[model samples]
Target chain A: MYGNAYIDPNEVNKTHSVLADEDPKLLAEFEARIERGEKIEPKDWMPKEYRKQLIRMIEQHGHSEIIGALPEGTWITRAPGFKRKLALMAKVQDEVGHAQLLYSAAETLGKSREAMINDLITGKSKYSNVFNYPAFTWADACIIAWLIDAGAIINQVANAKGSYGPYCRALDRICTEESFHLKYGHDNVVTLATGTPVQRKMVQEALNRWWPPIMHFFGPSDKISSHTEILMKWKVKMATNDDMRQQFLNMYVPKIWDLGLTVPDANLKKNETTGKWEYTEPDWDEFKRVINGGGPCNAERLAVRRNAEERGRWVREALKAGQTAYVVPFA
Target chain B: MNVAAIKELLYKVADDQLVIGHRNSEWTGLGPILEEDIAFSSMAQDKLGHAQGCYQILHDLGEANPDQIAFSRKADQFHNCQFVELPNGEYDFSLMRHFLYDHADQIRFEMFANSSFEPLAKLAKKVKGEIKYHVFHGNTWINKLSTANEVSKIRMQTALNESWNYALGIFEAGNFEAELKNEGIFEGENALQNKWLEVVCPLLEKAGLTIPEKSSWEPVLGGRKGYHLAHLEALVAEMSEVFQIDPTATW
Candidate 1:
């Protein structure tokens, strides 16, 4: 399960780090390759800004995968029965696998996985904000498996066409596995929704709680700027935040209604004339707060991760001692 | 066929797998590394499937469904030995336990593969293939970490020592062991334990870890007779928390 990479809106104006310093000839060739639908391989000549932004985006996506596992991963033990227990274990395992894949992809860009993980545990980097909210019930886990992953597919399927070769290839595999996760989640939700009244109430409440975060999952609507425009042209950002969010709504809102579950937003519907979805504006204030370390599970999530790192430090050091050198993984 | 004896054998084996699988699944997202996390979870799923396979045999023998049998059992009603119910103390402890327990499980399945009981023999044949990789994973990591450095070697040795007695509990004899051995449905626990030691002792020595002295080995018993440590009670309650919500409900 993943959410869109959260690009800080305020960083759009950092003129000092802009691509203006790149040689005009190389910059033109890079843009031309992207326009020709060529993937930017690891050793390709890319502007400094392109490399920096790709690292940030790909690293954040990887962190989101590992951190994302924490929420649903907790449910593996308490899953209802053998069917669910087995499925949940495999599902969360795929999330961890996704993190591994994403980390390797990011490693292609020169940042070591250890360095990226250090950034994650120290709060120097960010993952998807939706994970900061807790999965309060089994139904909450179901919602995450279904809707949150549904949103990720929407974001990732678009990015799978983006220019970076490794990230795009990683997303291609990720999207295939995520399709199974979506079906598993949807089946769980369907079981709950179509079952006893207690189950129905459980799923409905989970949906109510998760709806806002789902809306915020793609991050706030992008503000048009030179940086945003450049990333789009570079194929780093395949779609605007709102476009992906709208796509998610268009794809999943009907299915939610089909299950007889109500969206918490009264105004959520696809307008036939304008061909768009209308819903209550998500609480961007809360999104910013949560992404900046104030959400319900933020501290606990990072603490768990840090504790894992701390507990495993000796093993890491032991393995590192035997290694002759550090090798960057091939993309 | 002695159905009662066979069911007794099935319950203990299935419960062991289920409990240990539950313990292993707890490692999700928390291994020393991402690859290890995924490895544990994958093995966990295999364990759960193995448990389910045994439970399905039990269900065919007029037992409750797998979900009900697994979820409704109290800690005292379970037959899984206490070794698997212990907490995952650290990676060292967990890894050592994995190495010890998997070898035992693999050997048990190998013995079962040739049993007179056709259903269990067939299931055992399939399960043996899966547990093979699990043993391979356990052996690979044990060899790597145990030989890596002084700290790792010390930790691995300490983990082995702490887990030795509990690991011995995996073969706690059940009531039907004599009948099971005589009927050729399965060999008894003592044979399994002997073969387990023969298999693991050399591997541990090769990994450069010490086995606890024979004089100090006191297998923690009684879990085979519906007795368990308090750890199992909490594990059971947590495992069934959602299932118990609406017992008759499909979810």
Candidate 2:
């Protein structure tokens, strides 16, 4: 399960560098094709700014997947029984496989996987902030697998319709597997929510703990987000943050309610007239702080990832030794 | 038919897979490489699913359901070998254990493929095919790491030495082994042990690793009779920590 690609409010604050200058003829062809719903292949001509934004988005997304595995991966051992145990391992392993796919997808845009990983461990690149918080219980893993993955499916489905050929293909495959995880996670959460009192309490507490991060998941409301008319036109930014969040609440809030679990937000309900969700504003300050590396698990998560990179450096080196460079598959 | 013998055989194999499968899964996010992590997890899922299959057979034979038998049992009641119960200390140790255990598993399941019991024989055919891949994966790593460099070779050798006796314990016979052998339900532990050694020794030699001398081999027994090292209780407890919260809950 993953959170949406967080657009740092600060990143938008930067001046739109692409709008300042570019060869107008090449830019026109790129925008016109995107307008025609054409996929931009790896070998195609694209504006420098298009390449930069895509690299940033896909690399952060790839980083989110592998880093996202850590928390749920912890529960694979203590996952209650043979069924849950096997399912969790397969599920977590799928997330790592998604990382591999996303990394290769990101690679087509010119940055190497090694470079992206380095940026990640060095805190230059960012993953979803939701993983920076701990999964404190089995119930938390369930909630993440169910609700968080649901959010990712929404985000990824939107992005799968995107213009980049490799990333869209990768997302198509990812969404198929993610559909299974949603069922698995929902079954797990439902088992707890409608179970014995202790089981219900455990799930309830886990949901309460995760709700804040879930709220922060889709990023801040677009009303306060950056001007992205260009990116939207480029088929990069698919939907506004608020629109995705509303869609999620519309689809899942009733499911959570049907399970007889409270969502922790009293004001979390649809504004029928506007056809949007109305709720307490997520503390964007906390979101900013966490994304900037102040959340409970950020240090530990990055440390673990760094240690893995360092320890595996030898194996990675061994693999590259005398290895021939082949054309990477874009499909 | 020796019902007690079949049940005993089933429990030991099932427990071994469960424990080792759980250990393999511990490498999920912490493997030396992402591919290795995924490899271990794939094998882990297969092993765990195999355990559930064995438990389902037991369930059909009047045992409690698979979940209860797997989750509610204490360490003292588990029949897993001590080799599988040991903590995964490092990649080298885990890899060595995988190499050792999978060889024995492949042979055991292959033997079971011709068992007198038709159901077990049918299951064994499918399981043996899966174990063949597992053994291949283990052999590739063992061969590479054992000859890769001085450090990896030293680590693999050390892990093999430390785990040698525990690996032998995998063939500790149950009380009805002779009866099961007589019935052709199992071919007996001694026979299994001989085949395992025959398969693993040459592979170790080819990997440039030494097998400990015959006199030094003291197979840790009693695990088949529910005895275990200090590690089993902790592993069992950790595994069931969440399940014990509400055993009747659907989760």
Candidate 3:
């Protein structure tokens, strides 16, 4: 499962650059269509900015899936029994399939899958930072399947109402598949929670390890700016970072407590007055550091991806040798 | 029905499926392409499920449960051929092994579809359908890569040469071979090997890959009698790492 699309809070003009040269009439018409709740298809008249931002968002989202498969994929061999092994394999496969779909959606905005992959391997792009942390144990994998995917579903359910036609359609399908992931994850977690002392301790420790990354999942709250405003108006961003995170907390914190598990944050609870969950602020410093390639698994993750690309070069080259020029796949 | 012979037959196939399924799953996130990654995982799941199915049959015949039988065995106690226990050296080797192994696997299931053992015959009918797609996938890739270009063709050939003997080891006969045959519980390993050769040889030939000369056709043996390569031991340890934590606990 994926986190929300991570736009650098610092990349201000890069998001706003298309407004300077576009025809006002066309821009107005495009915004008007989105305002009327209509999707902006690939061939539709759009401001260059919309296409650029959508490409970045969708590409990063796709990259998240590809990288996300790595940590849990490692556990497929060591999963406790046939039931978990089969479930985890199919779940990780769905993550890869989600990458394919998202990549196709991004390709509709003009980036090729190869180009996106190159960016990912070269560390020129970003995926969900939670993946850069290790899945140190089977319990860790379960926490990811349950809580991380729980966050993704909240993020994705909001994004499914997004204005990009292909992305929305893809999210709709992805969300449906994610339901199974959520249930599978929850089942594993429940099994562990209600299980022996060893299992309970394992799941609790895993929860402690993952709580920080889970908090950073929706990303830091958006700074109010015209760029954010325009994207919101365009329906490109269906929800704010803080809003999605709050939705996650409001829905899940109680369930986590019911399991007799402690939230790593002692202050984690709902404010009966404001109706918003309150907690210690996550370390945005660590989030920024990890996103910038300083996390424990970043180098290893990229190295593995790059190695895969290098080893498969011949296969890809052999397939492409006499083929026609690449055509954008159907979204 | 000679239950001993049928149980022996089931053990070998189940062990092969479980071991190879474990090997193929190592490609979960590391395949040559995302599609191939997903494909191998899909096949891995199928193989694992098939292994579980066989173990379930064994369980019905008064053996331990599937989990105990699968996850509790030591490497030397397994019946899988040494071929499937080897590392996935590269995409080429893995693909080559897949093409070679799946063909033999499909034919074995097809032959068992008419077994006098009712449960074995029933499972064979269902599993044969799935193995057919596996063979089809292997064939499609072998045909494509073996003829794609010089580099791909040579890689495919080298992998084929290195893998041929081990592939032949897949049909290593068990002690129950004669009884299984006489009881009609199986067609016997010799018949299975001949039929596998008949299918794979022409396909490899059509793909422009050369079969090793008959003078060099010594099959690697002993896995059927419980000896295995160093790899299987480590693989078994790693595979059982979590289960062994508390085998009595429901994971």
Candidate 4:
């Protein structure tokens, strides 16, 4: 599963030299190789631009996992039942685990976990904008599970065949755990939808608040793009932004409608002609603003993370000092 | 036998679990590393799950739903010992509490595993499995922290001092001592306390800390009796706010 399909050695050399020197000929060869579908491995030479783009995308994905825990964590204490509490806790834990896997993948590119965390703390990095929205109530947990995770799974599944071996491996693990999250969220939402009218209202309200963020999760379409050409040529991203967003809409919009709940988008519908989903495009400016740390709960989320990191400094110190001939746990 | 007695017993168990669970949860997203964060958070979730179970039992036996029992009870009415209620001051303190409580809880659950009360026994049987992992986690942290620097040792000792009396209070018999022991409802408090000391004192000594001496101590009685500290009210307010907003509504 972790193995990569081999690429031509001369092509690898050309790609590296092109990236190192920004030669147009090498870029053309690299783009042609991607067009022909070859998996890039760690030992394989790659364009410098490709390495930079992959690091940026992968690091941002990792940070999103870390920050994503904050929204659902607020309700752990107040979950109505034992089962619900356990499930919420497990879901939050899974996100942290996902972050670890992604960070390790990023580390394969010669970046340290400390540096990534520092980049996040100093607001020099980008995570998914969806995480910046507030989880206002317990139902918001269901929405996060049902909608946010669903959106993520769509993106991840598209990237499952990514060129990087480590990133694909990490995505594989994340996808398995995410299946559990998806089921749990659907269960929660179903219960609420079938429960008292008030419960139904809570679900709807949460959906209303979360809809735009979920739609924007794929980022702006490639046409509005800046990094598309470099990212695509390097095989760092396999699908266009619009393609992933459309796939998400096609998969989830029907599921939401079947639950007898109203989706916030009035124009959302299936087109019989193109066999594709049609919906109002999300506000790209809002997407830009939210990702730039301007979302409603962005400041609060960062503050919480910073405080916890600072408070736990002593624990790390103690563990580091205590690591004398320590045995590593079995992987 | 009286309503007050039943309320007292229920609140005591529920509050202890809630406080300990809350303190344990503070480690979420902040463990020394990611895997440990997930594991620590899982333990905290298990504790909260157990607390919710206890509250459900109490609610069924009396006048409130689990939420009402957990969130509406006044602080003074909460019967949890002060030990579990304190903030998780640091990793060392949190680890100490886990080490102490998990050990005690394992032994306590072992006794309940054979309880005459079938429901309690069954619950104990389920909880015992989860507690096993908790104990392992506690032991892991203890071994790591004890062999570390003088700072960890110092922090652990101070945490022990602050929590020692309250930890002992976990086994405080209150009015149920004789009936519970005579009926074999569970193990007696004194036996449990002595067993706890036997297990804990040696560990503390090895870790370069001294166990404080105590003769007779006045137990903080209200947690079991439903009297709680000020924090319980705030905790309950936050926990139950959504449920209480529209009681008839399904959340």
TM-score (C-alpha, index-matched) for candidate 3: 0.98
Q: What is residue A138's positional error in candidate 4, in angstroms?
A: 2.2
Tell me the tens digit of each residue's lDDT in model 3 across A1-331.
Answer: 9987777656645656658798989888988888898998999998877888899889999989989999999899999899999999999999999999999999999999999999999998899999999999999999999999999999999999989999999999999999999999999999999998999999999999999999999998555322477778888889988899999999889999999999999888899999998899888888889999999999999999999889988888778767988787887
| Global lDDT of model 3 | 0.91
Tell me the interface RMSD of every candidate, in Å. Answer: 0.8, 1.7, 0.9, 2.4
What DockQ class does candidate 1 belong to?
Answer: high
Check candidate 3 and list the clashing pairs. Answer: none
Q: Please give the lDDT score at residue A251 for candidate 4.
A: 84
Chain A TM-score from candidate 2: 0.97
In angstroms, how far off is A276's CA in candidate 1? 0.8
- TM-score (all chains, Cα) for each model: 0.98, 0.95, 0.98, 0.87
Q: Classify candidate 3 by CAPRI docking class.
A: high
Tens-digit per-residue lDDT, B1-251, candidate 3: 88888788899999999999999999988888889999999999999999999999999999999899988989999999989999998899999999999999998999889998999899999999999899999999999999999999999999999999999999998888888888888899899999989999999999999999999998999898899999999999999999999999999
Predictions ranked by lDDT, top down?
A: 1, 3, 2, 4
DockQ, candidate 1, vs. native dimer: 0.90
What CAPRI class is candidate 2?
A: medium
lDDT of 1 by residue, B1-251 (tens): 99989998999999999998999999898889999999999899999999999999999999999999999988999989999999988999999999999999999999999999999999999999999999999999899899999999999999999999999999998788888888788888999999999989999999988899999999989888998889999999999999999999998
lDDT of 4 by residue, A1-331 (tens): 0101111223344544456686678667666766777766655666675776577677888888888887777887677655676787888888898888887777767677778888887888777777788888888989889878887887787787767777887888888899899998999999888888888889999999989987777777657654444454556766777787788888888888888899888888889899888888889888777767788988887887777777667667877883578432211
For the candidates in turn, chain A alone yields TM-scores of 0.97, 0.97, 0.97, 0.87
True contacts kept of 4: 0.49
CA error at residue B2 for candidate 1, angstroms = 1.1
lDDT of 4 by residue, B1-251 (tens): 34444445556666777778776766667666677788778888887877887777677676677656665555666678766776677777777888888888888778778866666677789988999999888877776667677877777778777667667767777676766666666666688888888887887788677676666354444455555666666666666666676655555
User: Which candidate should be chosen as best, given DockQ against the real structure?
Assistant: 1
